[model samples]
Target: MQSDLTNMQPPCGQIQRRTFLSDLGYGATGMALSMLLNREGSGQAASTSSGAATQGPHFTPRAKSVIWIFLSGGYSQMETFDPKPELNKYGGKTYADTVYPDPFQDPRYQERARSVVQVKREHDKIMPMQVGFRKQGESGIEITDWWPHLATCVDDISFVRSMYTTDNDHAAEFQIHHGRHKLDQKQPVIGSWLSYGLGSLNQNLPEYVFLGSYTDTRVKENFSPDYLGPKYMGVEFSLDPNNPLPFGARPQTVLEKEQANQYALINELNRISSVEYPHDEKLRARINSYELAFRMQRSVPEALNLDTETKETQRLYGIDENETSSYGKRLLAARRLAERGVRFTQVYLSGYGEWDSHQKLKENHTRSCKRVDKPVAGLLKDLKRRGMLDDTVVVFCTEFGRTPAVETRGSTKMPSGRDHHPHGFTIWFAGAGVKRGYVHGATDELGFHAVESPHYVTDIHATLYHLLGLDPTRLDIPGRKRLEIDRGKPILDILS
Candidate 1:
């Protein structure tokens, strides 16, 4: 008894924008439009208003895109990329007992590490390396035995062993991306700033994309665009090709042509409304999203479709195996997104706090490394062979490195795991603009602090911005004056 148009009718009231769209036989289109409007409602318009950089690049760019791989939970620097034979040599001894100076007594200890709860940490017992390490690749960089596959590609990577942060807790996760402690005023993350500065190479796809799921809702702040606006925030996507864009599919009742016509009519209506309210920035932004959403319905799914990939390529990403499959798919998807001109893609290779090994450190790190090592190596190898390495930068990092001493919580000095150590850690970069097979900076003998050329987290951001040919100092909003710490100096020594 009802026609297709009848089902879309509102229940006789003053029609809101959603209800008005629904009344016009908009189905999936209405859902997409409403969501886009709501998402843009909370913030300012994007710096890239019409598919162009509001402020163009400052100079020639070294990288066209970036793929940031984040490993949640802290990983041990000594056990991973930075090998410290001193740990094994000084095992079971306090700093005073060893030949090296006592890190606890060093003035830099209080200057660099900031405890959130104002509680002083005292872990005097040294925890020896849980895993053995050996020189790898042509560079002979010492890496833990756990990352055998990544070891093969060591010559292509540049390891920065002296990265440090101020936050000593899990909140360092956000600090790593935003370059600010949890106690300070939040700013846009690295990806958000990139999106704000560069806009999109592919207008149909989001300029900044985030792959993989997060166990904690608060982690969204790691990809947020606080003052720069919602348009710069990273858009979350699933690896599923059939439904990569949730709530973005057309209804069965709506034909493809009908949807197109509906979008056209909506665009016309919004433009007409703009004439009535010239100051309505949200309305103008909504008009822009309609065209993007319509184009994304096809582009996003195609970009995520793994079925088009060959079995050999699938195996390269370790998708053929179960242990590495989850992270493998996400990394592979990140590559696909990058190839399609996505400016920045953030891939969460681990769940929130997955690497937090407070006890049984050996068991946790061994299994955790197995889950990511091969796939990460595969990504590097794949990028190199495809010639994408020359224009894409890959970053592998975690929130912080584990403490060197055995955790002494509740007087359990013999606990197998290390505590969170924000005083120093290790992170690595590869491909495009960075020096190859190079190791920059260093931690102390016991890996207690970044003793040589220590870099705060924002320096990493500054480096990325510089690689993209943007000056971090010049990329700022008018009213919001940034602190000097927010605009860090680029690490020029590591640049090619």
Candidate 2:
């Protein structure tokens, strides 16, 4: 008898009952398409590093996975990790009131910002910090009162102040990973670099995974591998157990055993084609993707199902709470992915522009921090308890930071919020090879500039590469030359 999938009725097209893929995956039609796609600089060529390339990882690696937690809109450096008590000391004053040099007054500001001047440049008043901070743990790292849960994890984290980026717009979102101004050039994101350079541990899951809401879906450059090719890009998965892989489910009519047989048959056919096209890396990757997708049909669901986790474990992740539930689930899933050997998992919190507190920084940040604080702390604690901290790296960062000056977009001086400050901000790293309970670099008293050992965005990339035992410089392709800036120096001081 014909399988239910084969006999199933269709709504608009034959997709519901479609069976043949050999025509597209093989044959003369496919060969010509492959030739056009893989032409030099076309970014469709076979990977330089074979699947999970490690002909001896550059050095003995410290971390096996990275959980990159990115807050969608910029969070305030003054309000968050870099507590600028000076903002409270001299509130409602212009930059001129301070003895420091005007950051924007420098001739370099104009060129670096690409002419996107700070909103109300000179006249923008300094807004007082919205929250009070206290030292957390023995590290004496001062964190704002808004993040009690995260405060506990501070000793496990190393706060990296003096972090800056040039793109004044949300495009910094793209710049943070690409190592180039979003408007200027396109390059592979950090995840893609890792995915390309290192071999994955699990065959069932993607090496790079993206989980977050995007303000503009197109700016997902964080997961895109422009030159490394589409195969290196991140694969986004749904959190829902029933549809975690979304549209990757097995056919309704076919039983699991029958579906497995069908997959075997298709793989045999693809293998026959693989023999005909022995040099076609794209074809090999395609077949591997099919095999992976089948495996994911079982793996992803099992991984995402919360019912399997104990009630206490669920509560620890704040999965039982309403306000924290959504973000908690994402972090928990990220931890699960890392545990399963996914190399790089990028998790985004809140909706697009959710953290951009242009006005009322206190109200906006209080709620925003509450949503993620517990969940993040729980992930850290869980990982530590499981001994994963010794091998897993955790990162928390945003696009840039809110301005030290009050953001009076419409000339409302005391609107009580800050604008985007690309001059200086903060990010933190924990676990793996990174220094713990440490503070590296600093901004000025007003948190205006990265006064102490400032690092460009790419430095974070370099640090991650070092931890993963991949050298960005050595991973270059033959025809494509990477700029020196793209191979940022690793922040050695932050490493253990």
Candidate 3:
């Protein structure tokens, strides 16, 4: 009674591959990476179908796609990027009326007293910096006033402000995308650990995509890949550039060359059941996810075609506005899936606890930073005028910070919002191999502690596997293990 199909079908007895290749040189990394790309198209031009370079960030990598973005229900590190002008010079006072140091008598919040959520009357008061800072570019840095278009790209960003998360509630949005602790032991996220260890410059797509939505039902661990299974999870997408993978397309009563001869007779019956299940790595990742979901229906409708862009690149991602056209068409379909190499797209802005201001910390972060500052400063000025920001890395984050005192639940009155500060926060980074207009660790004079040099959110997944060159301690998984704080580390003083 339900199925009318929208995209992604295969389930109900999977394993496929009736035909070998669809030809037309399938493009955008499909038809099994159009038989493994060469001639640059980057994603590091391809590897590991054997010819070696083995599964890893083993070495040399600046980045080859990581868009990331984030932001759900927790945006206020003293009203954006750790600003605490001494909480407006001691706003209303009290952490025992102030000279710092009382984050509930530390001990990392007393050994995570059941992961911090009891504040009903604790709103501690002081709540000052409700937004209004200046400085901005030439690296003056200050930031907020609801990001006047991400403060003119602040010298291609860097920030970091000490971040620290242990889940003070809102599962610190699953500990900022599964760096664990939402009740522990749950690794594999960093787009399912780079879709289970890299190697793909596009192959039509889904080398990890997930674009938006999450009111925090434990935020599907932001694209979980639990024991690194389900073919290294993350997929999600839907810019609907003609049904981007849900019930997955292909019905108009079937004839698109009869749905390409019904997927070339189901890839000749899954290439004769992959020569009798030859060690089935999840049935060869479900016959390469059904020939990469049938070549991502012709390359995700030409990478979610925004009428092939331009009108000043659709008003530089404000997409002809409407409060920034729904997160500017999902950050312009994550910069057209990272200039067509799709290693880990992510997105998720607004909605689902819409930056949970708890009351009205200045009208909920001034309308969630005007629904995402001009589509994230037009995706860092269209990835730096299409040079794809030195190998594409981005990352802008949220999910912990707000409540430098002043979040009085169940009416304590005069406490207009903010409560959930996993002790400290702020995040930012841009383009591969970091360190640009910079600003690294600090928070306290009331942002309440990430004090200085704090990080620990899998050191932002060990600085995105050290800018996609990988080595999150030699990635591995045969009987699962992971942990040395899940190999985090890499802040290496913000790289580059």
Quick one: best TM-score, which candidate?
Answer: 1
User: For residues 158-187, could you state the per-residue lDDT of candidate 2 as single tens digits?
Assistant: 889988888878888778878888656688
lDDT (10s digit) by residue, model 3, range 197-226: 775776677677778765556676677666
Which residue pairs clash within candidate 2?
52-199, 403-419
Please identify model 1 stretches exceeding 4 Å from their true place. 1-42, 45-53, 411-414
Candidate 1 on 240-288: residue-level lDDT in tens?
7667887667776878898898888887787676665566555566666
The best candidate in terms of lDDT? 1
Residue 305, candidate 1: C-alpha displacement in angstroms:
0.6
lDDT of 3 at 106: 70
TM-scores for every predicted model: 0.93, 0.89, 0.38
Using TM-score as the measure, what is the rank order of every candidate, best first? 1, 2, 3
User: What is each predicted model's overall lDDT from 0 to 1?
Assistant: 0.84, 0.78, 0.72
